[model samples]
Structures are given as structure tokens and as C-alpha cells.
Target: MGKGAILGSAALALVSAARSARTVATWRTVRPLPEAPLDKGKVSVVIPVRDEESTIDGCLASLRTQRHSDLEIVVVDDASTDRTVEIVRQHVAEDPRVRLVRTDGPPPGWAGKVHAMYRGVAETSGEWLLFVDSDTESAPDLVGKLVAAAARDDADLITTPGRATVPNSGWWLLLAPTNVLLFDTASPDGSRGKAVGIGHCILVSRAAYDRTGGWRALSGEHADDVAFATAVRDAGGRTRLVDGMDSITSSGLDSFGAVWRSQRKSMVAGGAMVGGPAAGAAALGLGGLLHIAYGVAPVLMSLRGNGFVRLAGLAAWAAQAAAHRTYMVASHQSGATAVLAPVANATFGAQMLDAAWRSVRGGNLWKGRDIR
Candidate 1:
């Protein structure tokens, strides 16, 4: 065969493989579990809070209204100098299920969140342990669904990707798309079984938590959620991911600055965990540049009128965008955001490039810490 034929065959094979993998990862319908038997296993919910006064109330209120009855809510105040503690106190006063604990400071060699979670876990007792972020609001049935998923699947660790609600601002429109795009692409259905889950919401059986040594086992890791998931999988424990749309919504990002700093910090810290600043910078930089190229190349091809090339590019972009929209719609994201997904994807590619450069320069910052 000619070189062109060989190249064409290779391209076809690559596309076929990607499509097959994506299909395998797409969500499939599962038989819903029967209403969790009333008075089912007890659950202890642990949230780590630090200067999150503005968003803590909604998060706490949502927990107060959980459909599940046997729940104990524990909020660990991670040395917040703001009204975070006061807010928790108010919730604790109003709700008997709520408890507040305070930690002095994060110990050396531990991430702030891991440290806070450890503190909260030490003070709670239940058959199940849930670690949720302070900025996340759970649906009344969120806990029930998670518990049901665990019980039905006999899973040791269960996690759901939280829905991101970006503010209606140009800045957010441009930058906050990173999470939407990344999570949507990286977190297809079966992918969760192969990868570590995000920390935004994680639920584990108390028995599994104890067997794995819980938060303490991953205290030194920056990407605690992913590390914990890996640990669980490594130990022959079952891990499952559920569609969390009916279960939770993240407090929309407050500003573009928050988005930028958060992404940069994540890249740096994640990089450090793997191979330090240099390796992290290279990975982010190359990955971002390639993604940007992928987004831009189709537009250029369409303009050039190379019919076959244009068709291929358009099809690829549409496939990716539609897949994202389907996931968002399933997650109950606003129809408007789903429609604007292509724009969101392009913006995210740009922001990732910016984060890559910062990570390389050793200038990533998070929670007042220089991770790089």
C-alpha cells in the first residue's frame, strides 16, 4: 500500500480505539436500589472548613435536610480566622446531628484538607464515613443515593463528580470551564474504575476506611482523593462512581482569580507529588499546548476548505462537545451552559496553558502557600 493509505489506516485505527474507549466509559443505566431500609447503617459526614464563611451556610443547611436519618455531621474548623467557626456553631446549635471540632494547624508534610479530615474522623463514630467539601451542597437524597450505591454494589469506596455551577460572568465563562471540560472528559463511566476519584465528594464504608488506615494513610499526598482511590483499588477494594447530578452542586466559583489560582496550584501540587516542579511544569505545558492545538486546528481546517480535513475536524470537535453536553445534561447543568460547551472548552484550553507556564516558573500559590 502507498504511504497515504498506510497513514489513513493508522488514523482510522486511532479514531476507532478512542471511540470504543469513550463508549465503554459512557454512563449506563443501573437498576436503582430500593429505598434504603429505614434505620439503615449510620453515616458520619466529615467536612473540612477554612475561611469558607460565605458558602458554608448553604452546605451545612443542605446536610441538615438530608433524606437519610442516621447521619452525624462533623465539621472540622481548620484554623479559620473568619466566621467559619461561628457559622458552624450556629448550625451545631440548631441541629443536634451537627458537631464542630477545631484543629490548631496543619502538621508538617500534610495537606491542609487531609489534616482536617483526620481530625474530624477521630471524633466521629458510624458505620460509614463521608468526606465532603465545605463548598458543596448535597441534595436531600444525596446521602441516600450514595449509601444505596455502596450497599447495592458492595463497594468499599464510592465517589461522585460534583456539578460545577459557574457564575454568569465573562471571566468565569472563560476560566471556570477548565473543571467542566476536564471532569467531563476524564470522568466517563467506566473510567472511574481505572482512575482515582475526585475529593469533592467521597464515601467509604467504615470497615474499609479502617482497613485502609483512612486519611492518615494519604496525609502526605497533595492529591489525597486520587491517592486514596488508588490505595483502595490497590488493596482489592471495590470502587464505584455514581451519577451525582441529583445529589450535589458546587458553590459556583466566586471569581476568575479564584479559578486561575486554583488551577495553577493544583498543577503545581500534583506535579510536586509526582516528580517535583520541573516535571510538573513540562507535563502541564505540553498537555495544555496539545489540547489547545486540538481545539484550534479544526477551525483552521474548516477555513481552509480541505473538504475531507474539514469534515474530520468538525466531526471530532462535535463528538467531544456532544459527549460533554450529554454528561452535563445528565448531571443537571443549566441548558445554557451545555449549549456554550464549545466555548467553555476553548477557554479551558487557554487557561491550562497559562497554568502550565506558572507551574514551570515555580509560582503556583494556594491557600497562601507556595506549592511550587
Candidate 2:
């Protein structure tokens, strides 16, 4: 390698080490999802569903077990052609707290999930609204604990990272590294300018939601969570973003094509699902190059080099791998994944670039609907 290239790789290796340490230090400050009791008023859980037959049953089963006494579960059906609605209907009959709402479709300029949320709000009254994704299995104390934490923080909205896992090993290799992105974006400050959102589970107060026109205001976007957080923060409402850890888990992607489409749907404009193609592409390109330098170069160099280069590369490689592994372990995936940090980093970076392309190139699709 040229002197400049070697120097650049060394520089990036140091960068990776710093970030890795920062990742560890960052989590030390994050409080886990509380297991506290729910003293809060009536809490409504709204789960938006489409063709989710494969997972809806398990999701509802988990909700049925929530220990919160004064909770109502509303499963909104967004014109699913599958048995998703049938399954939710069974839950409605089985549990008094569980109710089913149906929407014909999103009106002229709204996203499916956003519209379903609006319908859910109209059907029942609750001081708190907990939006749960159809694929997550929550702990028994999800509602109460989350509410307790939100109340303590005086937050208008709170979102937490799920214990995200991939059922397929092949999918794991490409997607696990992206887990680092999920935890980092939500914010160390989750208050105003720094407040980003997580899509898995968000607990929001009905007052703040209504005051900010929450769901209705986010009617046109699939990446509604961040926009929702932004709306709340802009309105002088507080948001507390934290790690949910074991309190929740999400089966993020099952199919190969899903990894591609889902990443693109999320990569654009930080969840607004659209952005300047050039800007998106540029960011992706630069990030990819840096990953190759810090995340992949050391691994390859360590295996084949002179005495000095080999030892230096070995040290650098260890730092980069350790960082990636820390992220994998924190997200509840196996640390064994860090063994392939080089490959995983390269794959994830390339995937992000592909997502940037598809996102800006008008190819983003989620749940059979175009997001961009």
C-alpha cells in the first residue's frame, strides 16, 4: 500500500478505537427499561397491522400478558388481504382489553400506519398511547414500566431500542452491524435538537400527541417516528430515548429482499423516507470508504504483511472488531458475529450505499407500498 493509504488506515483505526470506547461509555449512562408499576391513568396500546398473520398471534399473546391493569389494546387493521385481521379478531373476543379497529385505506396523502394510529385514537380514550410494532414480543411489564420511566423523566414521548434479532444467519451477517446505527441515532439528549426516534416501541402521552397533531401531522411519511419526536420536541414537549434491552424484541428481517428494501426505506432523510439523491449518495459513498479503511483494511493487512505492518494491523484489527462486537452484544445478538467484523462492516456499508441509491432513485418499498 502507498504511504498515504497506510497512514490513512492507521488514522481510521485510531478513530474506530475511540468510537468503540465511546459506544461502551455511552451505554453505561443508559438506564434499562424500568420494571416499575404503572400509576399512570388508562394506557392504550395501538398496534398497526397489515399482512402480518405470521407474527400477529404471538404479538397479541404478549400484549395479553402485560401486567398493567388499566390498559386497552387496539389493533388497527389497514386493509390486510391476509389472515392478520382474523387473528386480531380472535384476540378481541378472547380479551376484553383488546379491541380491533379497521381502516379502508390511507386517505389521499397519508401513510398506512399513520392513518391507522389516527383511527385508533378516535376509538378509545387513554392518557397514554403506546405504539407497538406487529413483530415485537414485549415483556409483561412493558406498559407499566415504560410509563413509569416516562413519567419520571417528565417526558411527553419515550422510545427504546428493542432486542432485535434475525432468524436467518445469512441475513444476520449483513444486518447485525446496522444495529449500531439504531442505538446511536435516538439521541444522548432526546430532548430537542438531538432527539431522534426509534420505530420499535414508542410511549407517548395523549395530551402531547393531540396538542402536536402527532399522527395526523406525520400522515405522509413511513419514517414517522423521528418526525413524531421532532414534533413533540418542537412543541416544548420532552422526549426520553433509552435502551429497552430485554423488555422488547423485534424480528427485524426474515428474507433477503427484505433487508434491502427495509434499509432503503429507513436510510432516506432520517426516516422521512425521501431526500436529495446526491446528498444521500455522497454520504453513503464517504461512509463506505471509511468503513473499508477502518473496518476491513486492518483485518486483511493483519493476515499478510511484514513484521511491523502485521503487528500494527493486528492491533488495529482487534480494536475495530472489538467495537463491532460490543455493538452486536449490546443489541442482544451473539458476539460471535464480531469474528466477521470485516465482512459484516463491508457488507453493511455497501448495503447502506445501495439503500441510498434505491432511496433516492425512487425504488423504496415497504409493505407493498412506495415510501418515496
Candidate 3:
């Protein structure tokens, strides 16, 4: 009834409606790389590994099951102290399609992963190159489906917002949905400026990669995924972001701390890409604040006896929550995680701010390597 209530209700309705529409659109527009047979092409899967001993074995096990007959798997081991090399060597002995390359270190000014990727690409001769992470587990027909999708869409690069497999820990539940939200919000389209290539499972044609200058172009980036997509777009190549949930999944973080720490470099890079740290931080902070307002404003208005505003706020909150739930379900993640949307939002906002601060202060570190 009051002017304050009227204004608050309008804001809530608009934010809720906008988010709901995006959620529905994301689900409706982005379909998984469909299961289809592809005409045989030499497809190379390049995995850049560090100290991924815990996950490398399962990753390799899944790769060995890929149904594509002409597939070549190149695992480039960056100077790791763990048993990652040993685990990969065991796979090499068993599967002739798998080869292991050891990297002395990254070249001058190159990120470790970038160096490993370049080396891996050099060792393979496939027409289509898939740069996958060591933590990823793929379905037997993943390569077949992705190759077919790239061909069908006439896209040069295919990046996935990977289906993150959360651990049994409740901490994972609180933190994981933030990743989904970030992907859904920041780069809804796999456009040039806002591209979000999930580094864990990126599929790009050798031609497109080469056209974009390949790893060399993105050598300085901490978040190779976004950088890789951006480079492809800048080079006049088409890039598409698809649902790879059916074909691939990835897991690694065992706790909330691990998730937070691991995300810094990529988050910092993301902020840098979207203008600069201050602007990126503001955008992220506003998004999270808006979500919080949607959930909290109604309750506050109701306490102030603004029944109409209260009703609007509650409806908006419910709609926003439903939208998140729908997205999670479509993305093959747990719909239950949607209940923690507020927490996820706050966590995301905080992470973005921290990343921005770290970027301003000077670079950050990933896997003991400095990311500048």
C-alpha cells in the first residue's frame, strides 16, 4: 500500500521474472550433445595432468572405454610430485591407444596447463582435438556424440558447463550450485566476449584451435576455459556451449575449502575478462544481492504490514527457487541443492570479490604455479 512497498514489489517481480525466463530458456535451448554415430575421423583427447593421482585412474578407466575406434588419448604429465605419472603409465601398458608425454615445465610466461596442452597437441595428429582434464569421466560414446554435435551445428568449438559430480559431504551441497549459477548467468550464450568454456571437457577442431593460435594464444590465462573460447570467437570461429551431462562428468574437490581455493584463479580471470576487477565485482555482487532481496524483502515487507508487497516477494522467491531447481535438474545436478540458493549466491559473490582483490594485489597461484 505504501510507496516503499510498491517499489519493492515491482523490483522483486522484475528480478524474479527475468531469472525465471533465463532458467527456462537455458533448459529449453541447450540440449545435450545428442547420442549419434559419427563418420570416423581421427579424434584426439588431450588430458593435461598435474598431481591428479586420486582422479587420474578413474579418468583413464573411463577414457579407455570410449567407443570411438579412431580415438587417440594423449596424457601430458606436468612435473608432478604425486603418482600421476605412474597411474597413467599403467594405462599406457594396457591400452595402446593411450600415450603419456612428460613435460619438463612450462615455457617462458606460459601457464602449466597451457604448456601441457601445447605439448599434448603437438604429440597428436587427430583432426578433432578434445582437451579434457584429468578429473573428468566420460561416457563410452562421449567422443562420438560431441564430434557429431560439432559437425551438426557447424561449430568450431564446443564447450560444456560440465555436470559437476558433488561428493557425499554436505559442504559440497552448499558450494556446488554456485558454479552452476555462475555458468548460467555470466555466459548464457557461448559468445565471444562472454564465452565460458569448462576447461575440464572442451572439444575443439584442430583447425579452429590452430586458427585461434591454440594454447599459445591463451598461454597467459589462469582460466584457460574462458580464454580458449574467447580466442576461438576472436579468430572468427563459431563456438557453442552445450549440455554435456549425459556424456561427461567431473569430480575432485573433497571439501568447501578445496572448492574455494581452486576457484580463485579462474574467478580472477573471469572478472578480468568482463571489463576489470571493480566492474566485475560489482556485477557479481549486485546479482547475489538481488537474489537475497528476492528472498528477504517479502518477509521484511510483511513485517511492516505491507501485505501486497509481502505476497509479491514470496511469489518471487518461490519462482526464483523453482527456476534454480529446474536448471539443476536439467543439468544433471541435484535439485535439492536449489534450497541453498541464497548461500550459493553469497558464496559466489564473496568469491568474486576475493578474486578481484587478489587480481588487483597481484596474481594468484594454481597447483603451485603462479597465474598472472
Candidate 1 wrong stretches, greater than 4 Å: 1-24, 29-38, 164-193, 252-261, 334-345, 362-364
* Model 2, C-alpha of 29: deviation from truth (Å): 1.9
Write out the backbone clash pairs for model 3. none
Error of 2 at 35 (Å): 3.3
Looking at model 2, the pairs that clash are none
CA lDDT of every candidate: 0.68, 0.73, 0.73
Deviation of model 3 at 133, angstroms = 0.9
Q: What's the true lDDT of residue 186 in model 3?
A: 50
Instruction: List model 3 lDDT by residue over 155-195, tens digit each.
Output: 88887755667643323333444544545545535641356
Q: Write the per-residue lDDT of candidate 2 for residues 1-372, one digit (tens) a residue.
A: 578656755675676576666556655656666666566689898998989998899889999998888889999999999999999989889999999988888999888888998898887788999988898888888888898888777788888866755544434556555655544444544531446667779888888888887687878767688778878887778887777867887765655666665666676544334355566666776666655555667776778765656666777667656766776666666777666766766777776667656655655366766565
**Reference-based TM-score of each model:** 0.83, 0.85, 0.84
Candidate 1 vs candidate 2, lDDT winner: 2
RMSD values for the candidates in order, in angstroms, are 4.0, 3.2, 3.4
Arranged by lDDT, best first:
2, 3, 1
